[model samples]
Target: MTDRILLTCGEPAGIGPELAPLALESGVDFVWIGDPRHLPEGTAYHEVVAPSDPVPEGRLPVLPHDFAAPATPGRPDPANAPDVIEVIARAVDLIMRGESRAMTTLPISKQALKEGAGFGFPGHTEYLADLAGGVPVAMMLASTTVTPPCRVVPATIHIPLSQVPDALTDRVLEQAIRITHAALIRDFGIAAPRIAVAGLNPHAGEGGTIGHEEIRRFRPLLDRLRAEGMQIAGPLPADTMFHPPARSRYDAAICAYHDQALIPIKTLDFAGGVNVTLGLPFIRTSPDHGTAFDIAGQGRADPASTIAALRMARDMAANRA
Candidate 1:
């Protein structure tokens, strides 16, 4: 397999086009997989037949995937949505076949994909899992700039907060921990990963005064995981777990839900957070932000997260190799 990273172009109408130029600043070996027509006017790009093809100096190597129509800034064309989905699939196929070692995905608009192409999956993570034969995976938002590099996994993600109580089961939490622990070893080179688990209710159910899921459901599971000799701590209160002193205790935190895991890392290093998918056969990562429709073509999109994602993916690919 070629030591190349495939970057799938996301929603054409979003900042993916302009951000492509910014991604070049990352200084990693990656080829863009999208329609050249969707790229910003005057952006220098080289058309390569495959990821293994040699790239010349200063030109972005592009493995062009044609779209249905030309892009208009900030307004998604439903016609191009199908092609947008196809580009991601193409990248996955390339990676799975060992044409490339890893892929860094640009942000996709789930609403647009659903409305335009009848996309059924909630987001890229779910769709990617299905594409990989329904393997279970967890979403990790990891900091690229933090001292200890705050890595977090949300037990219940993309679902409404109401669903989280029922969804954040021992099974779900244990799977996240196992996947993360294994990934830490296989993809991150961590010999024995330290993990912290967050509590579900306010003050970790306040000794079951507020909620019993933490007492009845989660603790027992955590105890079992601990007995297996994995380095683990807590069912700690989410409110107090991310302070500087607390963050230093573990390599990663398994939080109860989405915001519980995300808020602190975004607070600590907003511009450099990366969204990583754990438990996939191949490496995958993306910027921790979404399509900024308001600034799609304004040249105001921050490339820091995208750059971080590429760097992280490159490092992950190396670690696997």
Candidate 2:
């Protein structure tokens, strides 16, 4: 059976409008959520139904979303932010209401969304979590790895390095571990996922020389996880965590800070990385990269990440089904 997915084009100014057609070929039933006006010329539009139908060749099925105002490619208007957010809300409703099985989100511009509209959260992960009634969530970046292959999650996300020390706590580390582990087994179909947790300080705090976060906070949580029979090993050196030889020991690397986790994965596969929100009521995946306003309408944006996200969403839905 084919899974029905709600595909949201995050921002009208981004490459989302261009990538819709490619996402349609990912071997799942997709109902696109965005303005029909934003769709490329010559694209056919279809209405949303109880049991959504598949798109035909030379046509794209779009579930129309309201845009507060008109959109110009590469020029983001805040007035349309509400409509952009509504697209997400509509997708969520479809899954919650059983109209769709999953959601694949295209990248949206946070600055444009906020300055143009009103949303309190930082990004998609936070917004999606709030939509699901405040279920705690973690963002994971998965991609093809060459030297050191691993799935990755940042313990503390969307925050500055100075705040990372204060945010590293026993509760945070343990929660991240539990969610990542369960997601691997239930969603990714990994029976026993080996998770590697990275330390906040250099050289695992250089044995408490560089920093005490590893000794005081993360280690205790890691110990507790071990006691729970989880296959976890970390408080490992952040610098060496992703090194080709050392990375094979684990399935996913949990980093202490944001950039520490993102840099390695983004460096490895910028265009193919998929940003997944684990522990959501419904499956939600997005391109790892963000809204590219620079080349919005020039037809120069690379849809690899969007294609990857669509493929991942299809696979995940099939796995769950």
lDDT of each: 0.91, 0.82
- Model 1: per-residue lDDT, tens digit, 1-321? 888789989998998888887788889989999999988889999999989999887888999998989999889999998998999889999989989999999999999999999999999999999999999999999999988678999988888999998888778889999999999988889999999999989999999999998889878998998899999988899998888789889889999899999899899999999999999999999998898999988888999999999999999989989
Local lDDT at 82 for model 2 = 87
TM-score of each: 0.98, 0.94
Clashes of 1: 0
RMSD of each: 0.9, 1.8
Instruction: Report how far residue 240 has shifted in candidate 2, in Å.
Output: 1.3
Output the worst ten-in-a-row residue range by lDDT, candidate 2.
49-58
- Give the TM-score comparing model 2 with the true structure, all chains together: 0.94
Cα lDDT for residue 40, candidate 1 = 85
Mark the regions of model 2 whose C-alpha exceeds 4 Å error after superposition: 145-148
Q: 119 in model 1: Cα distance from truth in Å? A: 0.2
